[model samples]
Target: MLSTKTLFARTVQTTARRALGTTTTRGKHTVPDLDYDYNELEPVISAKIMQLHHDKHHATYVANLNVAEEKLHEAQAKGDVAAQVALQPAINFNGGGHVNHTIFWKNLIGEKNGGGQLHDGVLKSAIENKYGSLDKLQQVVNGKTAGIFGSGWGWLTVNPSGQLDVVTTANQDMPSNIGHIPLLGVDAWEHAYYLDYNNVKADYFKNIWRVINWKDVARRYDEAMSKF
Candidate 1:
């Protein structure tokens, strides 16, 4: 509901106490700060885009998610099954938004901090084995992600079989919905690239690789592999 441009600009960032990932405090959801400055991902991503994406779009989801949760709890207390069911879409969309963006933010790191480099590790080995090389892996992910018809995400996930896979989700849907553990995710939504790349989303898709946090990807890969 907090979609207005003026209101979104005011969405709190660092100052608010947010539970990273799915954790919440006092039954409330809040926005967290970026690990790097807004401009840090520049050339690949503009400061303006990062600011709007994080402070406005992601913050709105967090705010709306809290509202939806409060409503759902009230409905539960009243034994309103119908109301509870009706609230599913709102909760899923906003909750997924919060969850996805938390991962998305961690998935990026500025080049100054060694963003794009894929170090030798389990993740790299998996990518090489599955797709031949990192470049091939990016191509596979880009192709899969660009094919998303509307707002969605492209993911490099580790499946239950412990195989690396490229997958896409429509509109804030996370890899967990399909029982996959996401190692890397690319936001294919227009808002993610409209400012910098305009209509050539493919260019954005390719450029995002330059800022990808492969170290984080590796860490995620190790954790996911442990489960399977």
Candidate 2:
């Protein structure tokens, strides 16, 4: 058996390697590939909308985020607080866009794969308890989503108390910024519905439910519960 000092040295070396690996790989954001084709969510979101939203919009966020982080790192290395402060908004916007869009993609599915189906389970039960039923929950979500003044997101989050709650974040802000664990989100930005719904945001909210991936929401709910 190795001596205690030798074991300690090996452990320290291993931890140092992990820390360096993490630092080297940090801030290299990439657009997450979707499981279904962009056309798969048609009749609700439309192929054109999905194509632009995923390919152009989300990819731009990932690219800009990488650039902003690189600049920020340089600022930090030189101890330039003003430069770091100036970079803050870009980091938050692009970072939140990346995070939100990643979740948004997973929260969607084609209707053929039981996309809108919400079977009996803890997640369903939680919805029922909170808003009386899943349909009511959708109604609530739609009402809240429609009222968003501009580009924003509607989210069903696990609040700090671990209860199901509805919240809205404006202009690419993330739900986590408000101490909520997002379970589902709907984009209210015009780009998300402009090609399809035209100016009618309510229609987009109503139709999006048909393509919602409830299974993914349920999985997120379970995981959030595990933490709190």
lDDT of 2 by residue, 1-228 (tens): 986645544443333223222232336778999999988998998888898999999999989878877886677567665666677777778878888899999999989987899989999999998999999999988889888897899999999999999999999888887789899999999999989989877888988999999999999999999997
Steric overlap count per candidate: 0, 0
Quote the lDDT for 16 in model 2.
Answer: 24
**Sequence-dependent TM-score of model 2:** 0.89
* Alpha-carbon lDDT, every model: 0.82, 0.84
User: Which numbered prediction scores highest in lDDT against the true structure?
Assistant: 2
Task: Compute the lDDT for candidate 2.
Answer: 0.84
For residue 115, model 2's alpha carbon misses the true position, in angstroms, by: 1.2
C-alpha RMSD values across all candidates: 8.8, 7.9
Q: How many backbone clashes does candidate 2 have?
A: 0
